[model samples]
Target: MENQQNDVKYEEEYIKNSRGVELFTCRWVPLNTEPKALIFLCHGYGMECSITMKGCAGRLVKAGYEVHGIDCEGHGKSSGLLGLISNFDN
Candidate 1:
């Protein structure tokens, strides 16, 4: 448990879906050599899941889980901005 907190591997700004409005983007931080589980978080609209999610993710990570996130369409670095995301599936 304590050891897991020490090991953190992250791949930031990775793409999930990239059509018109990609519905996902995340900071993948591997918390352990052998994670017990994977934690995925989808944030609120008009906002990315990087700030507070980082804190929550860190705690889960320390508990030996692979922490990940998705910034629903019109949010983070996924793709399209708000007020312009057509009828695309995000």
Candidate 2:
């Protein structure tokens, strides 16, 4: 994990959805250079983006790609009832 952190740039933020709900987001990119591609990662149910996706995102960043992740509405640092989604289509 320590090796992955070295020379890789990481960032976190919150985005508001149409319903005014805050969603947690994160990204990883190669340090001192632009990424050749962008990838969006999605974690499984009951998993947080930072925890489960970090290693993979780090590797991708090292491989000349930028990786972005988002915690679902009810998971991680997002605001909502745990393990709950109001609608699948939303």
Candidate 3:
């Protein structure tokens, strides 16, 4: 398994969703070439993707795939309250 940090590019950013909540997102991409595929990851409840998924993302990136992850609203570095909310019930 490839795990060289230099073989991949990592990035993090925050984006505001339609509800105006800021969400944390991160991505890992292979350097110098197009990725073989794209993979999106969603962390489980009470989990965040950045630190928890770093190793997994790195390996995928070095293997020629692009990986992306996001912190759901209220989880990780995102804004809002913890636990689930029924936003669609309004």
Q: In model 3, where is the ten-residue run with the lowest total lDDT?
A: 1-10
- What order do you get sorting by lDDT, best first? 2, 3, 1
After superposition, candidate 2 runs with Cα above 4 Å error: 1-4
TM-score of 3: 0.86
Give the residue spans of candidate 3 off by over 4 A.
1-4, 87-90
Summarize candidate 3's per-residue lDDT along 1-90 as a digit string, tens digits. Answer: 133368687888999999899999988988888999999999998889899998888888878899999999878888889856657464
Q: Candidates sorted by TM-score, descending order?
A: 2, 3, 1
lDDT of 1 at 46: 71
18 Cα displacement, candidate 3 (Å)? 0.8
Winner of 1 and 3 under TM-score? 3
lDDT of 1 by residue, 1-90 (tens): 112235776555645464654555555456336888788886765777767587887777777787777776666665666635566663
lDDT of candidate 2?
Answer: 0.85
**CA lDDT of each candidate?**
0.64, 0.85, 0.85
Mark the 10 consecutive residues where model 2 has the least summed lDDT. Answer: 1-10
| Residue ranges of candidate 1 with Cα displaced over 4 Å | 1-5, 16-24, 83-90
Look at candidate 2 and give me any clashing residue pairs: none
Alpha carbon lDDT at 20, candidate 1 = 51
lDDT of 2 by residue, 1-90 (tens): 223367787888899999898999998878878889899999888778987898898888888999999999899888888989778886
